[model samples]
Target: MARGLIKAKMLPEGKEVEFEVEKPVKVSDLLKMAGLSSETAVVIRDGTPLLETDVVKPGERVEIVRVLSGGAKV
Candidate 1:
């Protein structure tokens, strides 16, 4: 069997990245691989949000959105 790469589109930057995974891994783990913090980012697939514990298999496409916080003091 051959391994497939995981494709992820990083938000804000709108850049696509790819990586290989021998087996299914947690969304959080993937974030770490992309140098993203789970606390500030989220994994979404098929237009749905995925939990940190959600399993991400190889050859799957996912979107990583970085949640930003800002407010105008009025």
Candidate 2:
């Protein structure tokens, strides 16, 4: 089976993660492969927000971000 390699970068932290898996996999699967929390992470494929079921193609650059939480620091 063909496979795709993707790299994920964490914003504000500059952390990079690499993932390798079969091609035509869902974004959700990529998240899992990258060891990220699906609920807290927002995914973007090729500069576009992607759905969980969205198919990830080879050589496609993907980004993953963790939702920030902070308001009126107390």
Best of the candidates, lDDT: 1
lDDT of 1 by residue, 21-69 (tens): 8888899899999898999999999999999999989989999998885
Q: Write the per-residue lDDT of candidate 2 for residues 11-61, one digit (tens) a residue.
A: 647787767766667878877776777788878876888888887776666
Off by over 4 Å in 2: 71-74
Work out the TM-score per prediction: 0.87, 0.73
Evaluate all candidate structures by whole-model CA lDDT and list the values in order. Answer: 0.91, 0.74
Q: What is the Cα-based TM-score of model 1?
A: 0.87
Instruction: Kindly report which residue pairs in candidate 1 clash with one another.
Output: none
